[model samples]
Target: MSGFPPAQIIPPQVLLGAYAQGVFPMADQGELTWFSPLMRGVIPLDEKFHVPHGLKRSLKRRPFEVKWNSNFRATMQGCADRERTWIDATILESYCLLHRLGYAHSVECHDADGLQGGLYGVALGKAFFGESMFSRKTDASKVALVALVERLREKGFLLLDTQWLTEHLQRFGGEEIPREDYQRRLKVALGKQDGTFHPPALAPGV
Candidate 1:
């Protein structure tokens, strides 16, 4: 990964433009920074995408009610609720604006107790950037991930960018590719006009 200091406030257009070029921002030690990794992590949107046997069983149990764009800020907070996080105030505010503009979204899992887990990310053309996810209950975040993949597939999305590969994501077919290869795929995804975060035929429930 390579990075440089960024402005305190990243405009929505700038953020979208950066995503188009395969760069993204994070907050590090209260400072904004931009990075484009040498190897990019992506989750397959096709058949290669996997749901582990255990998670498949959890899916059947319907542990939580899945919803889209419901409590987006809360979902971001969930992802940021860890001990050390990159989702600082500036990152939070910028992404919230993106959500308002319909470029950012959340996949939430809720139960009788309240919000259990979820994820938040940015959607542009046929690409969806998986920023971060958090779980408040067992498998709640995993369920939300499964639901997100299904939704993206239903809407004909072609790319699922994870930024970096992690062991947690490898089970779900997440892999890292050279930045050049990633940029090529990103271009193809951005060129397509049919993909969208929200489609009229689909409701928020999953």
Candidate 2:
């Protein structure tokens, strides 16, 4: 039986344009695809959702530290570490390129040991397009997210776009809104960017 060829490489310019237009690329199997979902998932920083009791307890127990943009490449690699991940080598390289262009970001959660859980994504205007997150310990990622949202809100960011919603996200008040509504929110968020946030100061372990 015959097999597939390979996924087409998305031009960097095209990727940037797509993001600017509220659309993005995806790949189902072997094809590079673009999509603008009608129903968008987002977490409003002002209306921050509740932290689960178990996670809250976890946070208090471990007291993990939060870091921002400390290791962009490391965070991306960690998130893409899983065996069945959608983030291939090409996509990883693309994310790194975006970081170099001042469009990508990474939020790290760790402790006195080393890296634990965290997230990474694109930062355009006032919107934080969260791409993916990984958790090596419970509530570690949650603390990182809480700190990120606080910092964003403090620094005047307007939107936290998670792209698609999940049960895990629901705890953080992630909600689905109509495409038009989302676009409207995006407009406001993008318009309210301040472009400044404090960097993390955590050491290799702490």
Candidate 3:
């Protein structure tokens, strides 16, 4: 996707304000750039969300222990562990601050081998803007996604912003809509009551 001019630093307030306006930042060539795609990718929070048949079987098997906000920094690191990634030191440090402020969250999968897969995102009002996810084991990240959707639904969240659609995300009913339509939906989500990321109903390892 296209982006604005590079920025060396991104403050927490500026980052949150950008997301609230349907914009997000990424690092390109070691500089932070902002983007608001013409076609936005969003995963439906309702029944339209699909859990693949094989993943459902894996879920029943419960291959990894699911946890929320246990190790958020680790989760972000996992997402940035790719050969090529947009998550730079500035992005990492900024989001970690958001996590500490209770605005960012992670859904993690762990086994005896330690952390295997997970996802992280920013939560504002009733919307959750998914940043990235990673998997070190088969179906680990997918299972974490399932857990995330379940938690969002349970918490009364309305929008699941995926930034852009990918084939992997399409398997779970992720769709692309024109920017205008996306902004409308985003407004509704932001106008609603804020959704709690960690409700009392969830324990340490849920």
Candidate 4:
């Protein structure tokens, strides 16, 4: 087996720098792949995003339901199961460590019978950095995100970083600012006191 088979450990400083620069690393078939997408996706705190009418109605009805910090491992593993994934054994373990510390967090959505829908990342600071999310049901991921935005706004969070933009995110008021602007936001957020999240990472004031 090649030396690459083992998950290469990325230093915390390196990962943090990647977050500051709006970039992240992933393993592409055992090779390190770095990404910084041009159009970053993010939900504006004050904007109204259009959720599909059907989903909105569904939310009013059964409301599959959303919660924070409830099943971190399941959500992370779900995100890692995509066709091509970066959350290899080493990376997953590292992020779990981050979760244990006061760094990483997950916002989870569940169905009527308590099945996971999707989840996103949360790193406290002026900025709440969002990682990837997935959904088993139609509005699962989207509703989960809406709840996150609501929580962030309530918590007095300064920046909500989504890294890069996407069309699905556009319907939810996501927009792309220049890289320089992004870096500036990150710099301040990283420096200022933004609170912390450890295991039992809960919504603000929880």
Candidate 5:
């Protein structure tokens, strides 16, 4: 991380600043590395948004109960539990601090198996910088994502930043924008006064 500032434990305010500037940190060799992808992945919070038919069917079946910020730390840990991950101890601790400040939130999907899947992210103004997600049961994470988008849309959010493009994200109309274009969009999103990661209530029980 020669070109970047040295990794000190990131304070919540600084973390929010980084997100507002269109960058985020992931641990590399136990040190935080800041990333600003040249092509940024973002899901449109507009008419372009679409849920796949299969996922819609799953949604209809109501396989998981959706909740927001009810288990933030646990959701972060779940996302970090896979064989390889960027959500190291420092990253986890940093985000937990943000959650306490109301700038970070998790959307969770729970079934009889406990927390089946979920995702976490940082919110600034009208932008949601989606950090990571995980699923222990089939389609659990997807369900959580749908719930999240609905909440964001209902709250008049303008941006859903995914950081990088992936096939999984593409199914929901996620697209890559040039860094400059993303920055422009980010600027507009951050200019808005109201944005929130917390949903008004836990989603209806599955």
Candidate 6:
């Protein structure tokens, strides 16, 4: 797919505008490409939200200490440490800038060793565009996700846009809606944005 030329400098607000328009960026061979999928994947925060029995059990075990925005750079690095990733130096630097501006945030899971798993994304209005997640310990990322959803629900967020669905996300009831429908939802969500990613009280388990 073709994309707009990468700007000489990508300001954090520019990135936020892209997400507000329902598009996001990916890096390939040092160039940035934008995407707005025809079939968009999202995790509904409504009554249909489901958690697997195994993960629910893990939550009670309290395997990881969940933290928010404490180590945004480290969480992004962990997601990029994999063998194949779209998060290049350019993307990394830009997102770090966004985080500094409080428009991008990370939900991190840690054990005694330090950060074990986490995810990061951009928050605009009432929507969270989940970017990536990684785990060094079993259920570490899952626990982070649980905490993320609970927080979103508490904050009155209306949407959690995952961009795409995977087997990993499917277990949490990820579903795809047509672009038109997603755009409608996006419009409503953007209007409702409160300019905050501040999470509310976490669930009792963790």
TM-scores for all candidates? 0.90, 0.81, 0.90, 0.82, 0.89, 0.89
Q: What is the Cα-based lDDT of residue 194 in candidate 2? A: 41
TM-score of 6: 0.89
lDDT, candidate 4, 91-181, per-residue tens: 6766666665656777778876674667656474557778788887777787888787777777666677777778888877788887767
Local accuracy by lDDT, each model: 0.85, 0.72, 0.85, 0.68, 0.83, 0.83
Off by over 4 Å in 4: 1-5, 48-52, 193-206
Worst 10 residues of 5 by lDDT: 197-206
How far off is residue 86 in model 4, in Å?
2.5
Residue 28 lDDT in model 4?
61
Q: Over the stretch 31-80, how does candidate 2's per-residue lDDT look in tens digits?
A: 45567788888887886666778877776776777887788888888887
Instruction: Highest TM-score: give the candidate number.
Output: 1
Q: What would the per-residue lDDT of candidate 5 be over residues 96-184, giving only the tens digit for each residue?
A: 88877777889999988799999999877788889999999999999988888998887778899999989999999999999999999
Model 5 TM-score, 2 decimals = 0.89
Candidate closer to the true structure by lDDT (higher is better), 4 or 6: 6
TM-score of 2: 0.81
Model 1 bad stretches (over 4 Å): 1-8, 192-206
Error of 5 at 25 (Å): 0.2
The true-versus-predicted C-alpha distance at residue 120 of model 5, in Å, is 0.4
Tens-digit per-residue lDDT, 141-182, candidate 1: 899889989988998888999999999999999999999999
lDDT of 4: 0.68
Model 6, range 100-128, lDDT digits (tens) per residue?
76677889998899999999998777888
